[model samples]
Target chain A: MQEIPRQTEFVEVRGRKVQWTRGGSGPDLIYLHSAGGETEWTSFHNRLAQHFTLHIPAHPGFALSTGLETIRDIQDMAWHYVDLFEQMGWCEVPVVGFSLGGWIALEMAILRPHLIARALLVAPAGVRVPEWPYAELFIDNLDALRRLLFYDPEHPAIPQALPTSLDDPRMLNWLRAREATARVGWNPYLHNPKLPDHLDRIRCPIRILWGREDRLIPPAYAQWLAERLPAAEAVQFESCGHMLPFEQEEAFCQQVTQFCR
Target chain B: MQFFAFHLMPWDRLPDDFEQRYETAWTWIPNSLYEPGHGGTLYNRYLDELVLADRLGFDGVCVNEHHQSAYGLMPSPNLMAAILARQTQNVKIAVVGNALPLYNPPTRVAEEYAMIDTISGGRLIAGLVVGGGPEYYSFTMNPTWARSMFREALDLILRAWTEPGPFEHYGEHWKLKYVNPWPRPIQQPHPPVWIPGAGSKETIEFVAQRRFAYMGIPYFHIDFFKKNFDAFREACERNGYTASPSQLGWLVPIYVAETDEQAWAEYEPHLWYFTRKLLKGLVVLPPGYTSARSAATIHRALGKFLSSAQTRQDIEEGAYAIVGSPQTVRDRLTELAKWLGVGNLLGLFQLATLPADLTRKNMTLFAREVMPQVRASLAESGL
Candidate 1:
């Protein structure tokens, strides 16, 4: 199958230039990215692009996104997206959120319950599992990050996806992404401390997905989130780590398609 | 020339294989490594070195803040300064300085500094810092907020010291209905502000613009120091004022012995331990600690910690440490100080693993022999 063409575009939202890529032709679906800010229109994005119109914003402060300084925390990030969505006239849009993006989506659902119609949260990190802590994302160990993100050591794209070279120009972009994540999520680590209490506000139908073998955020969190959010179901993928969407891309997309349809 | 004895008060007992075993000397350094029994002795011994510097004719005694590291024992430099202020006479007590962003309601820094200043007859050089990257990790602080928090905290601290009481502060990071601190510093308009920085252009400009004393943090090539010092002068020039010698300081590790060879032998292993073991994660700054441009510049200098700066020759080549006979030490320091256009010297006499006796003797020799000659040289050389 041929890859879909993606158009990179930008718009000013709340004094920040928010950059996102758009492609495909169907009902609107936003693909919120992971801590890595998943800029590349990869297989998961491409697969989803075929069935839905994909609007992937680089979550201000990721690559080419500006005005990250204006954002204070994860709550601020949710507001930025909400403001952006409101400006774009995007309402009742389904979102496929991955990891950090998933956490933001959960925030959006809880904060502005009507903005999102439904959400597919893949290994979302929003609450702490004290016994099974989220493996560190904001750290000096890129090797550990990659290992935590991927179940397969020999994943062909691991080197390309998680570049380790400091000298590489791509590192600056990666740094920007991580810095954005850190800005929003550093203090309480990744999860908002008050999020679980207000999980009842997430009125949107949600499918909380997790990799059973996830190392970064344990699969137990899927059940934890499922028990909290209103009208949410938990699903676990076999032989997958935190990279649930990438590791089980087809199965993940099939589930998304079924749920969204 | 002004002289200050600085002590890192490092835990000197990291296993010999620390470089091989530990990923870093900082956060996540197993707490079991710290023995309170030995720590109690180290604190006093280190303070004694600073006190001895005071008894001697050094102009000041400097202490700084670091956390969860063998790098320095003083997480609260103000405490050390309080001790020096009370015990020592005549010398300035430079808490060079407090990591500003780490403190909540940063007014406490202002209050404590003022208390020390009042108690010590205005003998305080207030050093404010945004703090190092590892501190952000140690504190679990958002590095993105670091500079903003630092600027706000600094502004709040200064106001708390200088402005009248009961004023309100509405900053992005801090909000106070009554932004005031009692016991405002004894030195009118607060104590002389000293800001220590590596070679970041932002820091140089920030320091130079305010004409605050900018102490160059040590452990880099002399050329890097030269570049930063030169840049500081240029920055001051851009600010439409030539920086006074009082506005520039250099922190360097200095040691002297009976012979150059003996100095090298005595200082080499300790310098190695200081650089190789204690400085493990320094280069790995958390994202948003500094602007990328400055990070590049700062990292370029701090990269020396991981470089081939292992042997004494490598150390000297980089000018990472200054160790030699009294004559060699005197000449090298005088020449460098004059060349760098700096008037204040913060010397770390007690490096990692340098014993108390050697440290005391080193301070004595420096104060007695090298200082007078260096001062005379610079004074006579018309610098």
Candidate 2:
């Protein structure tokens, strides 16, 4: 398959330059990145873009996106995304969110029910099941975190997706992204305490996707989260961890493409 | 020329295989390892040692904070400082201090510190710190906002001490309708501020800009201290002033005994317990705990540091701790103190597993035999 080139776009959201990427030709699909904000438009992105217009926006305080200090919490982040989308004239779009980004997507679907037509949440962080709490990603060493994040730490795509050493230029990006995650999720530890009670407000059809091997947040919790929401279903893929999108790239693109469509 | 006795109040016991069994002494270390029954006796013994330091004529006795760690028992240094303020007369009570950002309304720090300053009868050396990386983990504090929160907290505390009450504080991290703290610090213009750093350029600059005393946090190679002290002096120079010796302090663990050989036999195991076990994983910098530049500086300095001093020779050479006879300790301390150009010496008299009696003996022997000689030597050298 020939590579489909992506175009970069920027819009000022609340006075901070919010950057995103656009490619392919189809319905607009908002793609939210995980804690280690995705900087590269990888193969999975390209695969998804083949079927849908992928709008990958880096969260505030990650990579080229600015204005982390402007927002206080994940709710604020959801609002920031709303502002970004409104400024870019994107409304009532399908949203696919990964990990921390999935939490934001869920928050948006609940907070502004009309803005998201459907939501695909991949290992989202905002709802906690006491039996399977999110891993303490902030404190764990990199090697251990990698093992927790991926089913196969030696996967070929991992070197590009994750940082191995402080010497790597991507170290700063990882650090900044984790810092932002901590700012929002550190206290409740990736979950908003009240989010579980309010999960019923999200009217859009939602998919809670998880990897069977997720050690970060136990895979069983995906069904647990799905059971709480009004119109949500749980999906689990094999041979992947918390980083299901990258670890099972082909399956993820196919799943996301199918769900969002 | 000033000796301040410092105590980390380390847990008096950890299993001999603590290092092998546990990856870190902080945060997630199983709390079951800690013995509740032994805690009271340990706390009382640690307090008695600091009191003994005061009776032995030390200028100050210091207590600092740590959280969820077997490394140090004092999660609230202010509580210990308040006890010392009343229990020990004539010694300055230094709470080196409360981790600024962890305090909900930083006025809590202002109120508590003021109470300590007042309790100590104006003898308080307030040491502000951007807490440890482990603290960021333990407290769930956003490491990225650490410095900003620290700076803002310091400003709020200073304003609470200096400015009049009912003032509105509309800051980024903290917003208050009215900021008023009663029983303001007894020290005019607040207590002497001491900021501790481990060779972070931004920290040194922050200390220099305010003309606050800069304390070198311990356990690095002696060369690390040299580089940091030089950077500090250079920072002061940039601020259009030469940093006085009083503006610099070096914290080093010190032990004294009847002979050099006896000192080593007495102190070696405890020093190992400290470095190998207590300090393990203490330097794990949380994400965005500091600026990237400062993190790099710390990494470079750490590359030179003996993380867990490999040998007695490494310990001696790095001056990670000074253990010797009265004569040997006096000579080495005077030489290093002058060489480092520091006016203050915060000596850790009671480190990990040093018994109460031995700690008292070390403090007494140092005060009686070592401190006077070192002070005289420094004075003779016009330091």
Candidate 3:
């Protein structure tokens, strides 16, 4: 069967224009990318788009979207997403996030809990586990990324190197976006102590899926979260790492679909 | 239900004028040093209060570990456990946690835990943890290996308890031959292991099925604790067992003063130090070290929390320790316990920067005026 292209569109969010794409049709689902923006061409996103009307946005300041000057933090990003949802007339949509995107989705749940129908956070961050430091991703260090994100170093699925060279212009733009996003919200980075307070207010069902071997954010956090969020469920993917959506895409997409349905 | 208290030795004795002369004097110091009149002296008195807890008919007194952070001065909780062991006669001494992965020879944990267990006459609750992200950077361990090392260390400690005497422990992270923990714990099969988490899904499941008590250190707020308790309950149900609230414990920063208004007023400065100063630079997410769930969880805590003007007040309201009158505290604790379905309450009366006198007052009030009624109410309800 021929693969369907994701229907592309754009909307103004928080004073910046954001490019979003969609494909298939069912319940509305929003996809937020990690530090690395939308990789819709990848088979994982394509498959996700096949089942749900996947609305993946190139988060402001990321590639294909105008850089955001006023967007100061993840909450800014979260509020912008709420605006996007309002603009798209998505009163209640299941939102899925990965890595940094997961952080944004969590923020979205906290900031605009009413807008979400259901949510999934893959390889998310935020729970303060003892001494589990996030690896330094800057300075062209994929080795640190490999060691930090993967549970097993020998796991065949982890890309041995960056999918594309860092110097590549396309890769450069993505890196710049990552840095800009990090700079605005970098100091404390991916957590709100108040979030634990606001979590109970998130009326929708929330599922936090963790890769057992994820080094960036340990699975232990899921346990921490499972304890705190009342309407929350947590599942651990033993064979996966931080990149659960991509590392174990088929299983991930299937689980999400099943949960959303 | 168990009751406990904490004192993070914040030194207050150093001359205020000393800072004018020396650049380093004004620099942030560890919580261990006793301040001349208030910080350190009060801590010793706080120790006396723990002894008083034993006298006041409370069940336990708790302490914990932290390093380089003024927030928690007890770098070696084992040491505090020893002090409490010698001073207090009857109350259980819970070293609520020791950072496991930070220690080498994992046997050190096995040894220390055993020592504390024996010293306390088998009254010890060994809390093992991976020591959060900041401790990882402080101890210079690869955040990537923290979970495996932490879990392995836990396994080794558990094995040391059950496996007869000196045996080989072969672990991918830790390789120890003839692994023997001397003075094997006074409590057979090890002192009860309780896991503490700010929030972690892995911790809840691990502690729940094992029937080990799970502690939620929701430092600031009570709201999210409901979710943690709920998740813990669900995990229990999934395992075909109903989790009683008694199976869970929660740590709250509590201060009980003469009046509710006085308590909040007295607690303001210390609480600010606890939230802002001590927490500054403490938030570090280096990347690639946590599981998928962690990275996807909370992206930034400080910036998000402190973005607006009322941030400080918001944090204070959320803090488990804001000072309140005895009746108010009792009411809050009662409501919180029933809300979270928790039986054991670990009250952190002494914070990193709170004066000793203030801390002691908080404890003494809780013990003398507040606790009896709280217990009576729970007993009355058969909760």
Candidate 4:
């Protein structure tokens, strides 16, 4: 698996002091994580950084930044990226995300297609598959969750233990951010029910890659996108789960790099 | 043996005065074949019944997925499971789960199952199933993919539970570099798994391989279940394993009363609800909604029922409801237990819109009289 290089830095976007890390400057690649935060997207970012200038900002309330009261929801985070794009003066860039960040990328495309040259969402959320309830699975048992999310338990990427207690202050802060986002994003246990219809509104080319074993969001939703997204294509990763960005980091990066190019 | 019951609670009338704030926001595909009242009290009653079932002592309640029809009120069983978790206790909540091929990201199924397990104190029976035909219409998912996805989702979820964190899983249909899940299950290995079937040879063969409980949901005669149970046993024998009684179960439409006549009369309306309203609504299934095997099984079952024709006698003879007094129902149940050799009998007490008094009578009678007799008989037979 290929690894993306990581660097921490800050930049002045517009008048506000926003924090972002820029690596391997070329065509900028903006990376975002899901509500759980940016820790998971790092590998994908590093791999993309090798080819394009990878720019990953700690999404508001993520990483070290703490200016906002709460992350609000995925849409607000999408706007935050739009604001970042304007501040950085990037004419157009390829945006990539894993899980929740993938959902955010789709939202960003809907909000401003010009800002995003292209999009690659890995196991993205927001579209509800008729037979599956993505949001409701969060409340399901671990085993069912595993079977539902991942294609293979033998895969190297599936995690065994989840953080049980988020008592630490940093973890607590992370929880607050997640809670804010979930408050806005969570409902009906399905992804945004309206997402399928909205896909046509996104003009940029979209590519979705899913782990066949992705236990978190079934890859079938990706199929729905392929059918509905007017300008979308999708691929399934063998023996992967929701955490495909890290589990299949090399292939994930390669797929994104190729798609963006 | 362990206990499991399927409940789709009954709700008679929806209050007229309540604000219709949620009407436009929510739509229900009626269980009835024909579109009856578009999003009416009947829908609200279905939701109410599911929530109430959690409060009842039923081991594990059942909910199914249907599209554009209100036959089974829960189009999203997971959502209902979430609500039930908050409302009930100790009772195992079952969502017969998302029809795999109809689901996207399949992980949503994983996440929701995990979340529900965590919330329900590990009292979750992971009901993984290939959803029936109506689901394909609602989601427009190819049925061919549904079976494969169902298998793939099961494999992945099992791996997530037993395997260590942050692993990679890749498959042709679904792929992921990382299979790690945060907030892993409260259950050590995973929750118990259950599968509902319409008695397909492939399904019976498949469930027998895992020794997972096979829930026979024929919607008609107990003899139909006998055939499936026999097939499952045969499959087990072929696989070099002796089939255990606990591995089998049958879902019978149940209603009890002080007298057999009263039970039969009261149960007729509810039976009418399912046959006239519910089963009729499910006639049209989307393309690629069922496997060739499942389609064949459904055709066989529907053919049997259709051949019998829809009549007052067929409905009265327990085509959909098993109506009788305590001993009479017990005798019928005992005959079924002896013939099917099942350890668990999942009494589907709620059939459409039966009155609450009769519903309570049915459950109370079964718990008080039928269960004890059934357990005693199983013990005495020593099979």
Best by lDDT: 2
True contacts kept of each: 0.58, 0.55, 0.00, 0.00
Clash totals, every prediction? 0, 0, 68, 108
lDDT of 4 by residue, B1-383 (tens): 34445654333333232123212111233334333474465555555555554454555666656545434556677887787777777677777656766666666677788898899888777788877755643554443345567888878877887898688778757888887776677777887777877776778888888878787765645557777889889999988898888777676677778898888778776676555544543543222234333544464566555224366567445444567888887787777677778877667777766765566667777777776676677667652
* Window of ten residues with lowest summed lDDT in model 3 chain A: A160-169
Model 3 CA deviation exceeding 4 Å by range: A1-261, B11-46, B285-289, B300-319
Candidate 1 stretches greater than 4 Å from native: B306-308, B381-383
Indicate the docking level reached by candidate 4.
incorrect
The order of the candidates by TM-score, greatest first, is 1, 2, 3, 4
Query: Which 10 consecutive residues of model 4 chain B have the lowest summed lDDT?
Result: B17-26
1 against 2, candidate with superior DockQ: 1
TM-score of 3: 0.57
Task: Please compute DockQ, using alpha carbons, for every candidate against the native two-chain complex.
Answer: 0.59, 0.47, 0.02, 0.01
- lDDT-based ranking: 2, 1, 3, 4
Candidate order, DockQ descending: 1, 2, 3, 4
Candidate 4 lDDT over residue span A199-257, tens digit each: 88887888989887665677787888777787889999886777777677788878987
Interface root-mean-square deviation, candidate 4: 18.1
Using DockQ as the measure, which candidate wins?
1
- Model 4 Cα shift for residue A178 (angstroms): 46
User: Can you write out model 2's per-residue Cα lDDT over B62-104, one digit (the tens) per residue?
Assistant: 9999999999998999999989889999998877878899998
Q: Which ten residues in a row have the lowest lDDT in candidate 1 chain B?
A: B299-308
Which residue pairs collide in model 2, if any? none
DockQ score for model 4: 0.01
